[model samples]
Target: MDGLIDRVETERKLRNVWHWLPDAVSEFPIETWAELNVTVADSNAPYRPVTRFESLLQKTTTVRYLRPEVALMEPCFDVLYRQVHDGVDVTLIDRPNCHTYFLSTYPERSSELLQQDNFTVLEHDELPPYGTGLLDERVTISCYEQESGTVQAVIDTDAPPVRGWAQSVYENYLSDARPIESRL
Candidate 1:
């Protein structure tokens, strides 16, 4: 593959990407999701439950507040994970320093309809522009430059699941909020 992102590497990256997505999104099967150049993990923290991620925002020298997709990618991966079987093994290969289009599709086998594909845009130098078609109301990205290191990413607002984040975060906070009670 010309762009060639390692399967394992992508899986790991995919997992990291989920941090940007909304918590309302469903979880992907770890085994299956491990196929892509990116994958999702338990995080193990459990303390910081995911809610409205608001996308990924980082400021770096290479890029600026560029695209919203990049910001929402974390939650996006969560949704994607459910759609792909053995996706963890699937490498999201693409050319370096390029832009690509990611289309949403419905696989006959799976029921969920919100899945995205990563395409490398070597033909284009800049990252691909955001699309309005994804599950979100408006998906976008913004990038900013840093003097020395780090890239800044900004995300626009999107509709949360009808239930919203308040309930989930509250539940988590309450469940573990209390100090451990001991019965003598």
Candidate 2:
């Protein structure tokens, strides 16, 4: 056919709109979380570790932190390696520009694996506000942040599994606090 149909014209409009509203009040405070973006790598260090960790992190759903140095990421990688062997899928979502969310179904296993010198177990209230409904369907998930450039993991208190996993991991970490010095 010479022509399939009549010609059509389309118009597109872009608008910038702003709104004013009152603040919200809740029993729990709404916290803020900044995206983790580590764009700097140590110039003196070899490029392998930095790219290795960055590549590993990128294999997951999404990761905010990037270009972490060897020293900063080595320990985390070690723990992650052990965690993997222990049957916990640890995916790096963020690094210490602050926090790393290990995307796994076994939060307890991940927590136990991460209980080391650099890793700390955090409570739900202690965590910054993440996206709403992020954990609604998740029964067990592990998320961590850093203290003084080290890694830490947290269990979602609102999750039913947290009542058991979080408490046990917290106790375990407190009972045995030691630094792990090894590489994968």
Candidate 3:
């Protein structure tokens, strides 16, 4: 801790990406936009302090990422994620207009691990107001349903032309990282 950047400075560095996106967007559920707030925690990295981020969807479609605690519990799904579940809630405001499919690959693990052995898509209202993943951490999706809320029609994880991304940035704030007397 003595030789590294402090927590305050780390938060500023982590927020670099959040502050870099567009300011507003339209086409949202309530005709309103959200402030982007997300948790910056790499597999082995320390948790960065929460900060609000914003990305414009259209002229009025903007979603603000916020809070890490909410993600671990009930995901707004507005952020990057992969979910695995046995089932999902069917009751919602609006439902998906089209049929969707979920694929399962056995190369990674055993089929017996899959509780339901199927992919489930929940209703739009059943999901959070923000973006979210159809599947949990497992290779399969949860219950299958209709949706059209703030959630995307379909998110392509492997798509190359997709928009929106979050990455970490490090900064140097220590007054003296190295002793001036030593130079190598």
| Per-residue lDDT over 131-181 for candidate 3, one digit per residue giving the tens place of the 0 to 100 score | 322121111001111142111111112111112221000001111122111
Candidate 1 per-residue lDDT, tens place, 68-131, comes to 2433343445443442432321112111221122331323322222232321111212322321
Stretches of candidate 2 above 4 Å error?
1-78, 95-156, 160-184
**Per-model CA lDDT versus the true structure:** 0.28, 0.28, 0.22
Residue 65 lDDT (model 1): 15
Q: Which scores greater on lDDT, model 1 or model 2? A: 2
Per-candidate TM-scores read 0.23, 0.20, 0.21
Candidate 3, which segments miss by more than 4 Å at Cα?
1-14, 19-22, 25-37, 46-87, 90-102, 106-184
- The residue ranges of model 1 lying beyond 4 angstroms of the native Cα positions read 1-79, 83-123, 127-135, 144-153, 158-184
Pairs that collide in candidate 2 are none
Candidate 2 lDDT tens digits, 121-173 = 22222222211111222212222122333222111224333333333433443
**Ten contiguous residues with the weakest lDDT in model 1:** 57-66
Better of 2 and 3 by lDDT: 2
